[model samples]
Target: MAKYVLTGTYCPDVLEKRAPYREAHLGRLAGLKAAGKVITIGPTRDLTRVFGVYETDSEAEARELIESDPYWQHQIWTSYELFEWIQAF
Candidate 1:
């Protein structure tokens, strides 16, 4: 599997919607973590951006996972981007 970086800007108004979906979102991550898919995940310091590092076989699959996330499904994100990371570390 390859590494990927998922990044996005949250909708300012997503706070209200986020509260309701946070649990479900975390639940999904917990499952991925247990399955050893996610490396790390969290929102930025200012909370404007959210990021996640994942191990996937393809960028297409990673993008699909992110697109299917509750936050994206519920329009909680304002803008987003995903990249296949070529890590030297």
Candidate 2:
């Protein structure tokens, strides 16, 4: 499986407003983990940037999976970019 990075910018206001939804978002991430689609997930040190690693055949698939996340559906995301990544290490 190829690895892809799903990067997105969060809506700070929405994030502050929906602090309670973090757990549900984690639950959805866990579902992806259980299904072997995601490798890991976390945010940048500044906390404004979010990114996740997906193990799949293509970037489009990764984008589709991320879009289905509750966080995305609930307007927690303000901007997003999908990339097909290559890891040399």
Candidate 3:
């Protein structure tokens, strides 16, 4: 598996807008975490962005995971970039 990093921007007024889908989004991430697909995920303290680490066979899989999330489906996440990480440490 390879490590991938995801950095995403939240939609405007995300704090209020995300309320409806937050639970489903978090539940999905929790399931992925337990399955070892997600390493870590969270939003910035200012709530403007989201960052996450994922372990997957390919970038496509990582992207699929993100796109499938309720947050993305519902527009809580406005946009994102994914990178294949070397994880030097």
Best by lDDT: 3
- TM-score, candidate 1, is 0.90
> What are the per-residue Cα lDDT tens digits for candidate 3 across 1-89?
99999999999999899999989988989999999999999999999999999999999999999999999999999999999999989
Question: Candidate 2 residues 7-61, lDDT tens each?
Answer: 8887777558558778898888898899989999877777787888899877778
Runs of candidate 1 exceeding 4 Å displacement: none
Q: Compare candidates 2 and 3 on lDDT and give the better one.
A: 3
Cα lDDT of model 1 by residue, 1-89, tens digit: 99999889898866676988889888998988888778898888878888889898898878887887788888786677888898897
Positional deviation of residue 3's Cα in model 3 after best superposition, in angstroms = 0.4
Best TM-score among the predictions, by candidate number: 3
Error of 1 at 52 (Å): 1.2
Pairs of colliding residues, candidate 3: none
Candidate 2 clash pair list: none
